[model samples]
Target: MADPAADAVVRQMRDAIMDTDLKLLQAVNTRLELVARLRAYKRSQGMDFVDQAREDWMHRYLAASNRGPLSEEGLHEIYGRLLDLTKAETAEDDPAG
Candidate 1:
């Protein structure tokens, strides 16, 4: 049999985690919307959507800002995935692509 108190604590923690997940989803959507706008602006300026220098700068910024339970490698992995997703999302939305 489980301790009722422990079960209650676990439920609370799970709820908190779910809330954080929802917030992360909201943030991702917001970022995607901004990416769409950026794509349009860049298109008007006759520029490519993929900017390697900007991505490098972002990685450095995130590395500097991270005070993490997540290691550097973990951060890189996550950001790399994010960049890939962002590019894919932008490409899908891009009319020219």
Candidate 2:
């Protein structure tokens, strides 16, 4: 049962998976930076940074845009968590936070 060829394939697949994970992290960081800039502008304009309608539209847009293997429910869960993470991250950056 020692298929050396299969083992090598699996090893390469894992490396690709790790690279994808790093790309995802980098994308999240980039999104976070954009969000921080938006927040700063909103603050300067005396506008609320949290936009419920925009968030709702984003969820709907992402659901419509997703072509998957990934279920709609899974996307929803991950997106919800990402939104929460964004808020938590921005909060930590606040001086009064």
Q: Each model's TM-score, in the order given?
A: 0.91, 0.90
* Model 2, TM vs. native: 0.90
Pairs with steric clashes in candidate 2:
none
Lowest summed lDDT window (length 10), candidate 2: 88-97
Model 1 whole-model lDDT (C-alpha atoms): 0.91
lDDT of 1 by residue, 1-97 (tens): 9976579888898899999999999999999999989998999999998899999999999999999989989999999999899888888868888
Compose the digit string of candidate 2's lDDT tens values, residues 1-97.
7876569888898889999999999999998998888887787788888999999999999999999989999999999999999988887766533
Give candidates' CA RMSD values in order.
Answer: 1.9, 2.1
Candidate with top TM-score is 1
- Poorest 10 consecutive residues of model 1 by lDDT? 2-11
* Model 2 misplaced stretches (Cα beyond 4 Å): 1-6
Candidate 1 wrong stretches, greater than 4 Å: 1-6
